[model samples]
Target: MEQPNSPEAAADRVLDAALMHVAFDGWTDATFRAAVLDSGVDAALAKALFPRGGLDLAIAYHRRGDTLMREALAKTDLSSMRFRDRVAHAVRLRIEAVEDREAVRRGTTLFALPLHAAEGARLIWGTADAIWDALGDASRDLNWYTKRATLSGVYSSTVLYWLGDDSLGHQATWDFLDRRIEDVMRFEKVKAQLRENPLSKAILSGPLKFMENIRKPVVPDDLPGRVMDRFRPKS
Candidate 1:
């Protein structure tokens, strides 16, 4: 038997309907209204499902891609790959999950508004967190924040480069991704070096001590930022 209707089912229907109109309407209220009509989902239910309408639809779309990436990551074998290679591959997988560039372009425009920029940033940070969690990151300290923060920068930049890329098979975007990842690696290397150097360590002791006290945020499993809570502090 088929499953009953639910909020998730309703959201998915509206999102699927919205995608066909996104290229035309740009994820706006017009698109949302069209989706509500096209999807045949109840207006009140759809409104409850997506209180913010098109913006929430864009969020749902982004999250769907994230879910697909996680599913892909779980099936792939990464044991033989180097750590950086795994990170790069994860990023590639995340970007590759998108089926419609126009939809994302529309979403980018929607999220670029001053009112929505912070929400957009939070979504990117969430993607970075999901990538790190899927890759088995064990850090429970300040490195947690730094890793997600850096990856968010890398992912966002790669995405912008990808949006404009027209070369064969998007090889240019992959090359750009590798260079960005390499930049992150070099930055991490320098940070490690500073931590290991006695002189720099001595000079930074006060700041380092303060940093040591900064721990990762803990969120419930059902929350959007749950990835940050996957690892408890080591005993």
Candidate 2:
């Protein structure tokens, strides 16, 4: 009897084929194509199975890291942790997760996403930027130092710069992050002092007034009502 074509079967075939390609030939677009050929799966089916190609697989890897981070963060009291400690914890968790996932992928024929050196730098930097953005206002505090957007950006930039570093110990990136954090803390102290001064308060009032003037107009626009009407089902 012939086997039925189910979504699960199709998914398995794609994953199995992807693993095979990764194991025999390092992960690459050409390797992906070869996997399809080896599996005898049609091009259209393969495309449908993995629409975003290697990017989709890479994103899956990122999601796994995110899940681990979220779970870890949930158990910790962010309010009590020092900024550097928080950033270190998050980084360690992500690195460990990726290392574990890479090991699992290695055991299979599945090829990991083939990221060139530049592409890898971009991914790491982008991830740091994303974390900075997520931390938001909490990052501005000196106690929350390393997780600050500016500090994170520095860390990311250092990582990118270190990608090509051929020197012993790779100490440049670590030094950069440390110095950047210190500089940010110093600047924050200066800003805090200014915030406490009467002259700075007067100067800040002008910006506040400007923001007040930029408020949105309270026009009685009914565009939302029209949009809702269109979505409403007919009686």
Candidate 3:
């Protein structure tokens, strides 16, 4: 049964409780129960709001970051910046919006478990997809997948780095992130150059030609819907 509050409101209420306990309890069943007690919602209501327990909260946590990132990105003036700068800022905004560093730290630990790793990857991919969409990327082919895959590495590594960073204002972690972005930029430049090279073109034109033989790639825009479907209860 649905709760009296709208889905969004109920989710927010549950999330409030979850954020309070996740940092210490690590998104376990114990944390779920604690969040339920803290939320003052009927036990069944809490279950309905978060059928997957802590994993749902973790997803909500990721989504909250995405929301925060989009809002923050909107306020920043990025029109004058380079493409890479915009992308980097988009990623940094997501991290900086975090109110509690340990929530992320605990989330990292939770996702690191073998059983949770796939779900973690899915969350990371969603974050990457959100960031790219925010950046106004128009590429619909190979670039779409490659861009998100690369950003996931950058975002994940930066989050892990930020977890341990003790510098004032996390200045050191930002410095590390800058270097990583530069690395990606350099790699992208190489790929662009390779794509333009005559030898590469010749290779693609050869008898066993490459580009034409490969099937077109498709990145479904409904990934989040598909992901949620996996957790939805069957009728």
Candidate number with greatest TM-score: 1
Best first by lDDT, ranked: 1, 3, 2
Q: Which candidate gets the maximum lDDT versus the true structure?
A: 1
* Model 2: pairs clashing at backbone N, Cα or C within 3 Å: 19-109, 19-110, 20-109, 22-111
Could you give candidate 3's per-residue lDDT for residues 113-157 as a string of tens digits?
999899999999999988898888777665677888999999999
Q: Across residues 73-92, which tens digit of lDDT does each residue of candidate 2 receive? A: 65667677787656644554
How much lDDT does candidate 2 score? 0.53
What lDDT does each candidate get? 0.92, 0.53, 0.84
Residue runs of model 1 more than 4 Å from their true location after superposition: 1-4, 220-235
Models ranked on TM-score: 1, 3, 2
Q: What is the TM-score (0 to 1) of candidate 3?
A: 0.85
lDDT of 1 at 38: 99
> What TM-score does structure 2 among the candidates reach?
0.48
Candidate with better TM-score, 2 vs 3: 3
